[model samples]
Target: MTYGPDTVSASQPLLQLRSLSHSYGSVQALHGIDLDIAGNEFFALLGPSGCGKSTLLRSIAGFETPAHGEILLDGEPLTALPAHRRPVNMMFQSYALFPHLSVEKNVAYGLEAEGRGKAEVRRRVGEALETIGLTKFAKRRPGQLSGGQRQRVALARAIVKRPRLLLLDEPLSALDRKVRAEMQLELKRLQHEAGMTFVVVTHDQEEAMSMADRVAVLNAGRLEQVDTPVALYAAPRTRFVADFIGTANLLDGTAAAGGILLDNGLVIAADHTLPSGAAATAVVRPEDVALAGAGTGTLSGTVVDTFFLGGTSTVSVQVPGLSAPFTCTVRAVQVPQRGSQVGLVIDAARTVAVEDDRAASRPGAAQETVSS
Candidate 1:
């Protein structure tokens, strides 16, 4: 599910944004960012709102001009090309379908603009409709289609052009949960069949992590990290990234000679090196945390609440000296009881250590990283 340095190479990048910088008046939207998207790979630009993922997507689509750096497609400079002239098509979040146009006409619009003949246009439109499994709905207008159907129409239109790259800007955000899940698989299948590169922009971690071949995480206006979903989840390069991508139990402590010393007088062994006395956060995932009966665990806590969700159970534990409650996930059959005292056992080999950075660096992150 994840690839390391041994599996990925930098030999060729289909789309490269080199030292890309963009601004609006006095506000900078993107900083000196550099990225490479491999050819035929489904790459995602993922982050919270105002993080500039959408701005970067538009810049790649030729909608926004960068103040500095270059946008290259297949090693060819595309910085100067206009949106319509570039071999790229974007499917907006809204589906952007013309209310009066039928599915077939919508899919054929791009071919018509490109001046394709009647026969070829019909053929491509039919193929595109079939590809998205919307051939039966070709005669229906936008108003007559469901959210997922409209999304398929937008996708068909974009792919009908056979563009070098497809840009999807939160294309599945408008759909319901069940529909969104189905669309995710459909999008992945379409990408494989087309064998074209795809660049997606989304704020949903689940969406990006589930469908992308690789994900590029953006913070503020800078690129924080880029790696496969599993790699990003397993070995985050920075604290912000570690906390942002997935649910992490971050315990702040002082780096001592042996490992890290928690404010609670607990010491946790770390695999990574850190200067003694340096401020750091020990990153642990809930699934990796084990609960033991009192006196049998490294740390002691009382169960405050428990939630049973079919396959997994989440238990919130209240520990003294910690700013907030910590949560851990276990098998549904292994649920913990509220008000019961339990010991916290963490897997040192599976843990990671990151230097604590500024606040607001990782959106939705809990403040006050672990305490003594």
Candidate 2:
């Protein structure tokens, strides 16, 4: 199952994108995107709709040619190669499977088209089906299988090709919520077992955070930030990333001695290196905001509402001098009554300070070194 080296050297990346850009007529789809993905790593391209994540995936798959830049696989350039000529396999969101073909035939279709011998095709197909745990259902057609099973069949077909890289475009979007969750783990397991490099394009922040070793966030055809899920969530370098990654209570202010100074003269202590008087934003997570007795913490606020979510409750507090309500996730058992005054204790160490300018942030400017 293992394919390449378990550990990739820092000197070289398996897939390299340099000044990559593409456009359709006057509509620019991709900016100068620079990225490096190591072998045997599960990387995700994450962004909202029309962010060029899909376009980037298609560029790598050889389906869309870029207007400029070079794509390198291993050490060779892949720009001149056709989609079929490249050593890459892409699985679409639809789980495109032949309805008339049995599981075995479907899995073997690529090999058969490659002119591989019947014996070799059968051997590879059997191994693939076994790896996917679908040996018992090899004779069944795509229509006979459940959503998850059909997804597995598509996975088996893609992996049977043993391509150097596997690209998935919202692979689990077709499944229900429960099944999508299951397949997330399944996809990770398969990637590890097969020792293949996986590049998944997704708009789901939770999905990318849960599955990828590293994620690259794109915005308006521009690369925003690229880092590990933990670093990306905990220490976003820009305002757009802070807002997009998860639920962050963004406080816009000016940089001060040790934190960001709000317009109301309250300085929220956070970690940052910005010069004093510069524009900044404090990124605070809901979980890090603790509710305390009024006048006991940094800021006092009135509880606007409370949403019970099983083990946790999200409390919205309306504070003076703030434009929007600040949200805090607290234990459901300690739910505070609405209209009650409460103090907000934001953890200084967990809170991050990011630049407020949306257009100035680059992909790797403030990112920590992430392993493949």
Candidate 3:
């Protein structure tokens, strides 16, 4: 399989970062981040605010120079290249469309800067507008279009340049939920059709999970885990990833003979043998724990709350051993009333053991491939 320039594949590294580190005075932002972004992949850098996700994206875009690192795009060192000289384009959070210019002119801005022939610019701009489904809106100005349309115009402008890599910083943060959802699919379609690598930096977990092929979860300037959304959710590698990726019941426990012994002395069967008597935590997803009729299961708790969410409802059960009530997902039809007793049967096969890394857990919160 030929890669780079002609056709790209998962085995081909289009963008690679090695020993990337950045700091702001005494505060370290990124600490030795190494990533290999495959060709034509939709990759996401996810983390909360101030976790250096933005800093990392900026470094790749040549906006912020890293304290130490190297960025290579298709085997070419990009760290030394200026933002304008690099074969990349960054669509900022604000869209940054020129309100005074027509949509066609806005889309033609990048080509015009490079001094392309007028006819060539027009042809490329027309193709980009058509690709982004904005051909009819070409004559309209930014203020004349809706929020989503304006975003498309900005995207058209970026793609018109035919950059090898596109860096989008908070690409959908400004749109409403419905528009954001629509744009998510649209972005995926656009990326697939274009066959260009996209590195999206986002704090929205839902956006990242729903859009990208793989997600790199970051926290406090450190790499937490890089995996597919399903793996990140079902098999988190650390406590921080478990807490940030999805709703998790982190029950403090001690590693003992059979399993991790909870505060109430209940043992949750674990797949790995932990250091005996070491302090640990059991990470359990809400959907993984099943609640049944009381006295018919291995564990029991009193229903503290029930959240009705269309097809499924979450049941929060207050157990004596767990600090926070364990949440179990049940069909909306099976939601029990609050204050009712229920039994929780955990599927041991779904549970994974990892180090108790709560110190990395903090409220912080992007896409890849058509298929690999």
Candidate 4:
């Protein structure tokens, strides 16, 4: 279900942002950043609010000029170019459709503005409508179309110009969950058929993970890490990334010989290079943990809660000396009842060791170098 980074060359990704830094007056929004977006790829900028992912996207789209560094498209500098002059189109969160204009007219608006002949505009508009599966709704005004149809119209409008790169800012946020999932597939299909690079900015990890070829996670205006969704979830390079990307039981620990020594008196065997006694956190995802009988596991805990999610039940077990409960997914038949004592067993090979979260990287502090 996961894909690798685009085959586009890193040296000449369709778009690139180098050493970009921006601020809103005194409050800095983005730190020095470098990123590459391959052509014909679906790339995502993912992070929590206030992390500057949006600012980075806006900078590339020419909505906000960075205070430092350059924007490059196919090796050409774009920092000085006006947004309209650039070979990029942004589909805003609102869909920004003209209610009075029919879908076909709306899709042709951009081409018409550029003085594209009626024949060329008509041919492209028809193709884009067909591509987005909105050909049947071409004569329908925005007000008459469904939410999903409006989204398709917006996409069709944006791509009708055949821009070198498409910038989408929460393009699916407006739709309901069911429709959102459907649109995710549609968007992926559209991107492949259009053969244009897509740079989407979203805070939703699931959205980014499900849609993008590669994702860049940002924190405190700096990049945390950038990789395929599988790599980011399976092998996070930093503590923040391991915590933010997905559900992780981050146990405070110290690096010791052949393993990490948890503060709770349990040693989880892991391969790490950090010197012994150095601060560390053992990153254990719930799926990698198993619940066993009281005396047969790595650590003992009492089941505090169980949640049934169809095929799996998530059991929350409270361990001694820990403030929060350890969460693990168990098979429906293997779930323990509340108040039952159980032991926790983690898959050591699946566990990752990273620096402790207490020593987080801040804007003015030295940060671990994250690959882009």
Candidate 1 similarity to native, TM-score: 0.92
| lDDT tens digits, residue span 1-372, model 1 | 111112223586878899998876656778888998887799999987777888888899998999999999878899999998898889999888999889899899888988999999998888888888989999999999999999999988998887888999998999999999999989988888777888999999999999999999987778889999999999987787988998988888878765678998888777778888888788888888898887676667899999888899988888887777777898998887789998888888888887776544443223221100
Over 4 Å off, model 1: 1-10, 359-372
Best by lDDT: 2
lDDT values, one for every candidate: 0.84, 0.90, 0.83, 0.86
Q: How many Å off is the CA of 21 in candidate 3? A: 0.7
Residue range with the least summed lDDT across 10 consecutive positions in model 1? 363-372
In order of listing, the candidates' clash counts read: 2, 0, 9, 0
Look at candidate 4 and tell me the lDDT of residue 221: 86
Q: List the residue pairs that clash in candidate 4.
A: none
> Model 4 over residues 1-372: C-alpha lDDT tens digits?
111134457666778789998877666778889988887789999998777888888888888899999999888999999888888889999999898899999999999999999899988898888788778888999999889999999988888887888899989999999999999988998888888888999888999999999999998788889999999999998889998998998888899988889776778888899889999988889999988889678778899999999999899999887778999998998988899999898899998998775565475333332211
Q: How accurate is candidate 2 locally (lDDT)?
A: 0.90
Local accuracy of candidate 2 as per-residue lDDT tens digits, 298-338? 78999999999999999999999999999999999988999
Model 1 clashes, total count: 2
Residue 241 lDDT in model 4?
95
RMSD of 2: 4.5
Ranking by TM-score: 2, 4, 3, 1
State the RMSD for candidate 3: 5.0
TM-score of each: 0.92, 0.94, 0.93, 0.94
